[model samples]
Target: MKRRLLTLVVALTVAGYPSAAVAGDPLSRMTLAEKVGQMVVSYVYGESATSVSAADAAANEAMFGAGVTTGAQAVEKYHLGGVIYFTWSRNLTNPPQIAALSNGLQRAAMADTGIPLQISTDQEGGTVNRIGAPLAISPGAMAIGATFDPRTAYDAAKVSGTELRALGITVTHAPVVDVNTNPRNAADGVRAFSDRTAHVATFGVAAERGYRAAGVGTTAKHFPGLGDTTVNTDNGVAVTDETREQILRTHVPPFRAIIAAGAGSIMAAHIVAPSLDPTGVPASLSRPIITGLLREKLGFDGVVVTDALEAAALGDYTDEQVIVGAVRAGVDQLLMPRSVPGAIRILLDAVASGRLSERRIDQSVRRILRTKTGSPYVVEPPVVGTPAAVDTMNRIAARSITTLRSAALPLQDGQDVLVTGWGAGTTTNLATALGATRLYTGSPSDTVIAQAVAAAAEHDVTVVTTSNAWADPTQVELVQALLATGRPIVVVAVGTPYDLASFPAAPTFVAAYGYQPPTIAALAAVLQGRAQAPGRLPVTIDGLYPYGFRAP
Candidate 1:
């Protein structure tokens, strides 16, 4: 009779929660454990978690920090509403595998919790593309900006969403809407799609459309813009000097457009936009930026997420301080905080003590709930990564490879290439792609120069690639030394094209913009004359290359 009662209890529990749609309605019926779970945003390693049987309850304990299991455990166990996919683990090599793993994890998480997981990934492409899967192609925001068409931005989103959803990610933290007007910004760099306000607006709108079409919800990021700021939010103080007019006119357009297009979320930047809030509180924890401006003026009603609280950008503040401040600032999600269990206690205590209002928690929870089952995310995952689609992604990326300024490429056969750069990854990859049996001497030492001269004696072309001054001066000097050698040198600036301006003598230079493997391969192909130099410069190179210069 006792056994019968236990079996009946299990059956009643299953019957009580039929689906996610109805599960949310009884949110008030949940226990204390479930309510605390909803406040968490944590990180996990897919490969390491793969070793533990996902079916085991112990797997949840092992994968998550103390007390949490799967992200769904936050939902089922804690009544959590969301989880942001952090990519600190370097092994996620391609989109297909990442998609499959993420898809499986989210599916299992939702099944465990009886609530849909707000699964997200950082698919910004270029320097920030996290999923190596074929579905989520790595096309940076810059490429979309260069296209200057909402359709291009939309198509990239659609493709990205198709891949993300297949892997079971319903949310994508992307379309970095920061207007990068500051030439010296250390963080945004190429992460921004454009500096032009209207152009950015167009791209953001299209991106929202594409993600929606692909059945994935979009999040417009780095609110209040990090583009013109001179500070790095992760480890340094940051402030944007844009006037109120400039802020509203230039930086806010993209956010407004994407929001209007029904983007489900907006990620507040860690940088300080003092015009919006002069206390120097970073936008991520500012009431004016989050509630006053984003919610009131621009009329954004979706979830407001903070950039990773783990970023050194917030400085001196304790984790508890940051979490409480973000919630108070009207942020709906606290992204990737260092401690989930600790944060939950902090938020709950704050609410119990009246430091945070219960009404406020309800507001954020409603937005999060609306987003997970949002209209844009009506479907689970969209079909993406067809052979043709993959081909299209590659082609778009190849076409977006800005050359800055260069003489004809693919050095005539037998050209002696002089290559110098930090990190073995960039230099060796370029050599293999160009197929040049060239001499590689990394240092400017007397012995190294002597060897390089000897190697180049038999070759007609020299190819040199290096990080711009943004890295080290030695790299620039090395390129100058090669130029002094009077070899037919071709210089490629992997970081920023501006580094070449300091060059003693500008040889035929090509700006590949970034050092991703595919970008390097495409660049080498252009140098070997195997591929056409079809991409034009997306930004100015000052003295070395003009802003709009391109070579055929």
Candidate 2:
């Protein structure tokens, strides 16, 4: 049967149908159950989960059942179209383990349907990286935007894609193209490239091209744009109040560019945009937005994936509602539905009842199968922790470090310098790189604040690192206390650029845009005058520094 199906697919491809659509030709060959299964992408634990603690093991069993412990088990039970990997859930340790896991999933999938599985991860770089440790971490989207060079975007994504492909991941949920115009947007921050539509479009296309060059599928995500929202949909509903014209002008351009560049998938945002859909439904469940706007208006025939169905924004809806609503909304894949079995049952029941037509289900299944067959996962030799990849990542980070205020640059060697902040590892690494005489690590506690202040008083210069200080009042208070010491301080906003607005009185400020080791080393080099800071602010922090601001 498998040979016969392969022969049919080859014939269709030779007949000149697009290779993607040819593999799933006639769609009538699949049973209703198998077709329904193609619309679902389930999550499974990696091999590393075998070493998890008793409590975590029990929790995983409770959530996914004892039978669904491994990717093969999940594929066997759910007949899923793809697998979504989470480092925390899977406890993934290294590259070899990830490759083994991918191969296992693919073998299981091939046995079931003779089709490859779409193995995917959120390798967005910086803080959101899941394929952790030893992989060369890039400086993320905003850092690439800070350089204002599309080539930097291409190189960063190509390296990232190469590493991901080598590990057997076929799809990367990355290159967030949202124009993060609102400085107060907590959800987007450094994840977005820039506030300018043109910048987002230009760099977004480049990143997409890089991913394609490396033989991995790229997802231009959180569409129509989550850049204007202050609330993260993972926790609660976020409403975008931009007028329709404003959205068309600002938020929609980058997605258009990415689609034009042939992005394989698009992840719809969970935020509500009343301007796009008058019903005020979150874009993930709105047919007007996904089908009418994205499909009809934008002419995107690629897969439309919803953000995780379990997000708090969809809390009011039941698992059945979300599964059915997303499909009815014209989504091709339902990501991380609360229960795989429950979702499958709901979809089957929806078709059985008059709630959903079988034709709609088949349409989605064909699109998914086409994507899977056309983009077969070809495993590359593992390249994690390779020297050449690391070098490229470090060079990109060095170029992305933006020195906003540099009155204290060229710190004298052997100077009495105190380094302190959140992300203790980054602080320690930067301190060691800069030859700081002392290091104090602390969160925003009263005791830590007191210790930091005393240490600041004793040192010739103080270097304070902040990761989202504006959001954490404790960090804000700690920085304020350090500033009150009347000691010369160079503040390093390592996570988000907006931290500078909270500490405007600091003598000098630098925006690293991330906490990766390479970015930290770049920050250290800039302080020691070993490297020049060339990055420009990607977004305005209002009352602090405007976009494109950099020290002379």
Best by TM-score: 2
lDDT of 2: 0.81
- TM-score of every model? 0.84, 0.93
lDDT of 1: 0.66
Residue 388 lDDT in model 1?
68
Error of 1 at 405 (Å): 3.2
Q: Over the stretch 464-498, how does candidate 1's per-residue lDDT look in tens digits?
A: 66654544556666666667777677777665556
Kindly give the stretch of ten consecutive residues in candidate 1 with the minimal lDDT sum: 1-10
lDDT of each: 0.66, 0.81
Backbone Cα, N, C clashes tallied per candidate? 32, 0
lDDT of 2 by residue, 240-271 (tens): 99999999999999999999998889999899
**How well does candidate 2 match the true structure, expressed as C-alpha RMSD?**
3.9
Off by over 4 Å in 2: 1-26, 48-66, 373-381, 437-443
